[model samples]
Target: MNLYPFQKISFLLVITSTICLLYIPRSLGAEDDEQYLNCSASFQCANIPNIGYPFWGSSRPNYCGFPEFKLNCTGEAPVISFQDKDYRVLDINQSASTLRIARTDYWNNVCPVSPGNTTIEVNHVEYASDVQELLLFYDCPPLNIPLPIQLTSQFNCSINSTANYINYFVTQNLTNSGLTNISSTFGTCNTTVTALVSQSASENLAMNSTKDNLVAVLDSGFGLKWDASNNLCKQCNGTGGQCGYNTSTAEFTCYCKDGPNPSNCAGKKKEIAIGLAVGGAILFGIFIGFYIYSFIQRKKKKLAALAQSKEIPTPLTSKSVATPSTNLSQSQSIPSYPSFTSKSDYDKGSTYFGVQVFSYTELEEATENFNPAKELGDGGFGTVYYGKLQDGRVVAVKRLYENNFKRVEQFMNEVEILTRLEHRNLVKLYGCTSRRSRELLLVYEYIPNGTVADHLHGKRVESGFLSWPVRLSIAIETADALAFLHRNDVIHRDVKTNNILIDNDFCVKVADFGLSRLFPNDVTHVSTAPQGTPGYVDPEYYQCYQLTDKSDVYSFGVVLIELISSLQAVDTNRHRHDINLANMAINKIQNHLVNELVDPLLEFETNHVVRGMATAVAELAFRCLQQERDMRPTMDEVLDGLRAIQNEDLGSEDGQAVVLDIRADDVGLLRNMPPPLSPDSAGTDKLVSSSTPPSSF
Candidate 1:
């Protein structure tokens, strides 16, 4: 084969051009991957019992998701894209309310190499980094490439900076304008369009109180809806929007209202009208101009006076503007919360717990610039810093990596979502502040005992898991909280050992509500994607996108199982079946091997009182894990059953210890117990857990 040098060189040139032209956009595309959520079946959203559009889990059902992005819960943790290349399950974020993931590296084939203009159909969630919560993107450079940030429709971030070592980061202070659509040249987006409906502040969803960070989009939509009452926005309902106030302590927005359009511009139309009316009148032109000018000046003065008189009362030397029923400022008089019914009273600091405001500078000093040392922990939303205010109270301050206006709405919900809330086992939200960029901070009575996971794993003051009485108390309290939520038509989705914090005496307090939803009768179970921790999650939730109070029962059941075994959710080294704590416990107990599955630390009292509580809890856990969601008991029924067990008092002469003076038929799901976990999305897997034990609670 003899070929001329020029001929060979020409062919090589063609190959080089082809490679560059093909790889450039795909490479740049990686830099802008702001894919905030790519859930598989394994990713746990304790709040969400099912998966839906823009989210793919049961990948086995079809090639769902971008191939290989299939997810499933492993009784330990949820696994994503299990057998595919770069198949890694990242994190379930409660804060910011987005699903974060680590993606596998692959080549994008722009088929029709010899021609052009190919078509790709998308059936799953397609997130264009240029149009979503920007902080969620990862390091997939050619590092630090200048990229455009896009959020929904009509909102775009034009950040054209050189990427350093990190991937494209979400610019803080980004606000949401109800997005509609975005367009790119040649369907590729050399430019994108973002639609901002009104001038509302950034809406930050409380990702998930205590679960992740209270900052995720709970429900976002733009269907056939509109609320033209207060005249706030058009084309959107005030349904999902939350109202929040700042340091001024006053503004109350129940939701958006109907207001006039650009024609409603302050002074524009009236001024023109007066000018016309006078000019046409009997030579009243000069008088009308002078009179109108004076009127305008007076109106401006009144507006200023109103602004000055409108102020939220303040504390002696702090930044808080106390809630004063009589002295609300004009600005405070404006309602910023969504139009949901008054769920509770957020105005009274005495009822619920809330946070105090600190100048950004003061917060900086308290946290030593949010130093890693003052850091208590890092969560899905951002980081938590422990600090002591000058008043001598030790507090935990959460600084969000991104801005969240939606979280403010939750504060409104805390104050007004439902009505009537009274429960000792639940954590109280005193107040909150979405000012100075931290965006969301909740002040609660800090509990010193750590989480239930700590005690159960044997990692706290007791130096071992709880005694039988303590375990009984914890179970009862947690159940009581669950019952309360159910009563209010709300579901505490992420109920687990970690979300259950203990105090010095081991009293349990249920925390976190980012995933809590108003389970109104009209709305069956919510159909968002599945969310929760790994090992302890429910299977029915993953199989169907319907979240009910029953789902919470399933997750709480996992926590009960964890309390019994004193084991972590997952241990990579054990047999797949044994790796699941719930499965392991059921198998051992069913085969009369209760001794093998029970935590030896609680050698306290296998007596009736202790055994009775354990037995009741185990039975309840078993029902919650029913293969059918309907088969699960409601939290109220669970509580009543526990109360009955408590009333029995396990056969004590004093009478608080008899094993239910009642019969089996009296119990519903608890009646004829089903076989333990059987192991599948829809089938119960017999229980078990791996070898390594996590810390004690």
Candidate 2:
């Protein structure tokens, strides 16, 4: 084991050289990391400071972070696009992995006046746990709820001046309690939307009850956390390597002292090895160029053939017609439909509603040339034909008669109203075709199940009787639809069983808005000739020329009574005293003879819960049928009452009589109701010219 002095010295020198060679890369890598991290210069946007990885923009390149997380500095604010929606970035905290964003449309107040469809679609970012949602209700009808609920940001909508300034109330709780209970607890409003608000902003809303405070809180926006995993960046920074991404491979790359590599600090020797490999690859690529070119040409041919196979045939027209981008333009040349004479005229009709204009040929093909076999129903103004479009969409095509000017007016009115209206419980108007035919045609979403009238007392009665629960749901849904309409300053004007269609699931879809009147936001009542079904018309409206939402409430009351008694609104077979359903229902309810009017199919006597719900409904119907317009309850109140009855029914079935404790101040139930008219008033019923006939379509 003895060694010469020269041999030991040589061994120690060899050991020292090996250790120095290994330590060189680590010390050099640390230096490289500092330079790489500087690639993403600390960016300052507005009040936000020190933004770097996971968010690249301004002076930073895409390789520094995710490309989708790019921010655009517009004016003094930094804007980011998430799922195609632009949001203003308020603050960024890299340590917390969170960012504050406010919807650009909301901040600018460029969104629709209604908040029903206002929703945020966050991509790769989630709302923070402390986020609070504020619900804004616009153009809501006057509700008789408690003062505190009513006082929540009651201000007129800038767009809808006719409306009693829109009411909005913010809530942290969204569970369904009862219709009136919830509407009263939360202001009676339509179109609910949730927005994320800061804890301080929410506290401000609670402490300060001013509209300015609400606007300030909403403008301040909410917080969102990102899934930014910075492990690679940290590792690269620690190793003295610059963190970046390989564009072609979309993989993280570390820029070291020597060159770029997939891992931290691959030193000078590896860089030289990579350079030699690159030179060899370049020479090999030159040799294979011709073969690669041939392969790409063949691939291109295959792609062209595939595209040709998938191409749809374009329609042929005389004189090389230019394709129209919109439905109105497609029908503009058709001289038969004079109503759509110009682009401006068509725009006036279809622009506000955003309804499509189907080509005449498309409708003709969809409806099989209006074949009689496809006919769904016939009405006074038009005939509805079932049709399946080329797109596999089933629709109801109503081909109007347009026999008179009045009929044409109705057709135009329906087109204008239905296009603007959107609700789950309301039938959707797909589009309209007004060319290549003598009559105007309207397309609506086809509901496979028949109308409430058919299911209850009309042709489809033999199919099966509706259960109490189904009937109750229809009532609540219909009420909700009406309330939504009223909130938007629209009156259905024809709320009847026939107008209430059902889907395959027995869900209500309120249809037929031909007679609907758009009450201006500033006007409480529109002065028009009274027009509605005879038995359902508000008596006050029948006697006077003025029309209000209460008129529809009267009609809905008749529909409610029909749900209970399963009788036609104007059934003659009933005793002469009970001919008009509204009048008869009111009389029976006042006399405490509601049980006698219950539908026999309901089997009310066998179920105590059913009996109580039926009685409660009858009372609600009575309130709706109040002779004076002022005495009638708002549709919001009606929906709440129906929900209360449903909840109570469900509760009773569970062996608990859950009395919905709706505060008296919330409900404001009418008392000391006027007595029903004597038999003489019924005998003296007179038809007036000012009264428009019932909806036949």
Candidate 3:
């Protein structure tokens, strides 16, 4: 294997040149690196500070953001213009890809410089499901027919002249018996304007159709969801890259620390080749070989150091990767629980799935020594208490009822699952107590309003606040969360209205993951004893002891029926043969009695739109309630069906257009079930028997 010195030197020079060329190209791109840093930097406006990617302006360059997401920060609030029309950005929820914006021209005034229909680009952004349209007819003639008292409101306005004209504003798609031949009357107005408001605002306008209320609703603004770079940004950021847009290409670009790439930072990028002239000198080639060997050794040491000191948090797995749980033997005694209130205790304590490890004493002080008045709610696993941490953050603390092995397992299971799952509709877990703590405790972001159950039939039902639109939103949000869980190989064994918490804006926050199971990817279903809220438990799971994603769907079906009917899932006061709400809904839908099942407040009969949507929802619920798990649609399908129904209802051009073509015969064809059980002594025992899963929190 002897080689001449010249030949050996030639091979070394070639190898060194290749290595240097590889490093030089990545390091030479100073302009690309600067753009990456610029895009990575977050900005501050008057109020909405720390605004980051997908939105750039002022201090940030064009390459830092998408063209449509540019912001003008010189105003009182962040302003984003679409099609030359300016909108005041009230709020931005980056996680949800949603923003609250109000029309600048019509913020506080009924009249604007130029009245036109509100336009939005469907490709860039779209209105939220809960948003509705309102039509404002201005400068109308003295009407021969009076405006509907319920659907329209008339007010006097003086525009350009001393003469006064009657102005009317009507809620679109909410036509009732009170309004007839309204289009011709609206055509008589000189100026017509269309505006969008939230569904709750539209409902309030329907209740008291006044000029002042309409003005207030218009001032509040509506929610819009941006879709231009949501998926692209996720792909870029997932690979340790800064998300940006190439203005020249008009396409998304991923900016790595090294340089710019098309998809992600780690993706193989285009390389540039450099040619080197051969050098016959032996000393130069020998020096290059030594440099290459030293560089390799240094890189190995650097990687080894990083592996030991750095802990990368992953959303797909448990925190055992960071601080593994100790396996205790039956013969071993319980370790001494420490008072984790001091800084030293915290420094020594282990993290729970990359989340904070709270102290028993600190949580006790936060909840006022576990006062009964501070209690928010209770579940099968534990009771939740409303608390304010020392740092002044309002939180809901769940205290496990027992310190048994099963309770500990559930506590660890929840912390592992919740810390890995992130969604706007799912409840946020702030932290939890260690396994050695006196009692298991979980802290979550506090939701002030109440559960969906409270609004439907519990304490808040008398207020009649949960509108049909809000209920539909709740169902869609819950289904979305469940679908996300399924995608992540998890199942929400407990799905019920009581677990669906609502905030002031009627946004859903699904809680209670104690009964959830992290399903194995290799298996179709997990075999375990059925455990969940009685009325919401899947009948097939109870019978076969096989838990699948469809179990969540079955539970959600009961939730949907409850939303439309406003009936409790399990009502002993109801007919014994129809004790279960699912059973009652099936009997009603099968017998073509959906009108009887729907709540009167939803205007199921008066409002054709409501009738169409409710009937369609009832049919979907029937499909979800199929006894065979194989027949029921997946949670993803359920979410899509609900969204389609909502979009159709909101997309109605005319107020009278039916959202769906569902008929009585169509309902009959969807499912064929046995007749309702007779209300006899035998049936009563069967309805409320031991075989029925016991009802729990």
Candidate 4:
């Protein structure tokens, strides 16, 4: 203990160094535990590589990833199980957070006749949006001829060729109409399985005619996305620790050198506590210094104020002056209204529509100042332009003409109608922009495929001849949309082929609600001046000046005729007796000459079953086109009739019994009723002479 001052200081430093050195190994051991938890070594499979976190197998331990995402490498390829059903792992992209998986049973077998019928259900994974569904029809009866559907491949199941059935696959989503047609036409067949397939594979199935190609497409599975959120596992990985779930405790445990903990590491707690204590002490010291400085500055300010108060000022006398005249020149211009700069300002006029009010500048930039190259088409209301927003969303912008006073009313009407309606078959309303300089604009979902008219008339370059099944499905979907609108007390006054839009997948989306009117539940009809395409307009409404849901039925009836004949509603080049399609359709159907009226493009001459279905559809159209409103069926009834026709049996070679009555109640009425005069020849005079006008709106 007896030593110099320098010797004593050296002794204290040595003791401190020894204590620090003793704590270093514990820290290093903790780091080693964190590394053990990672298990980041790449797990090489047949072709897949670097399969780590969120997936564990092979050399990776169970504690390295989520329990549900465990992979098994027992087979030639790595496999994963979802809902107890095994799926072969085709590809794993960690950067994209996606997994390509296919059912093991379907992958191994060419014709999954005895499939497990199990659907993969991943808790934290979602099927990709591009996944296409395949409907497998089994045990279908032998056909005399090939049907209109795109038949992929067929197999004979039995030794007797007459007893054997065929299997067909089409690259289209199974709709209610499709199901009904399958049930009706192939009464003996059953849809055994519905499976998800990749978009590329779906396209291959659609384009290629070879049966072997389809087998390969089915083997390559669909894609799925992992739902990984910013959670404890990510945090643990960021802090150089391994993330694992403790199934017994139902909690996330971070693996460290010492042991598993609820957080990243155990030693970090002591380090954080020490840092906080030091920070708090430093903050307290600064607060004291600031208080003392403020006190001194306040004293100095008081001293200066007292010194300034000692000075004084002298008084001055007033002088008389002449006031200027109140009157001024009237040449000054009035101030103009300010332009809108934000959404709040734009929203003042868009409250009724209840949609996003995009700024004019934003849309201008999106459409490159409405370049002519971007113009999609022109209509009665406005010109539509295809625009790509800054956020990478494609939109259809309808720019209305500013001079037409009626255009404003139509614009507001469309906005109001679309805002209140939401359905899969209806086009989505994005937003609109209203400004003094620019034309009134309405934005909508951009449908790449053109209208039904383009496809039917062979005007679209990308589209081919629409098959009979597709045409029937379009009719059903359109009818469904109309029924939905009618149920909501909304009448689509203008129902035409041009308004029925299709998507890339050929799904129907009814658009153009400019003339749509909302009918009240308390009222029987909406009385207004007739406003619709010439041939499609209801004759009763035209003469009596009364609009009703039946008017829409009449218009839709004209569209149905168009679908059947593939002819313009009002073709002047047509024969004088067949000028108006609705009139011609009614006459041909009443006289049981549906074959003459069917579209030659449909190739119905050989297929008797399809020809019969076409005839039934024509009859339905005739009912919808009745002269009297009361005689015509409701949209719901029309939909039911279409569905019934689609579900009708296509008589077998064995001569099975057929049930083909569309509606039981309408049979007698439809048979005995006399034919109404042609809409063109009868004119307004005939309609007024026969019936009384309905009540006004």
lDDT of 4 by residue, 558-667 (tens): 98888888887877687755778887888788898888888887777886667878878888899899888899999999999988877775533456645433333332
**What overall lDDT goes with each candidate model?**
0.45, 0.67, 0.73, 0.67
Better of 1 and 4 by lDDT: 4
Q: Cα lDDT of model 1 overall?
A: 0.45
lDDT accuracy of residue 448 in candidate 4 = 61
Candidate 3's C-alpha runs over 4 A off are 1-351, 403-410, 649-697
Query: Which structure is stronger by TM-score: 1 or 3?
Result: 1
What lDDT score is found at residue 552 in candidate 1? 86
lDDT of 2 by residue, 448-499 (tens): 6667887677756665667777788889999999999998888887788887
Give TM per candidate: 0.47, 0.44, 0.45, 0.45
Q: How would you encode candidate 3's per-residue C-alpha lDDT over 447-499 as one tens digit per residue?
A: 76567887788755554445676777788999999999999998988888878
Q: TM-score of model 1 relative to the true fold?
A: 0.47
Candidate 1, residue 52: lDDT: 31
Best by lDDT: 3
How many steric overlaps are in each model, in order? 130, 11, 0, 0
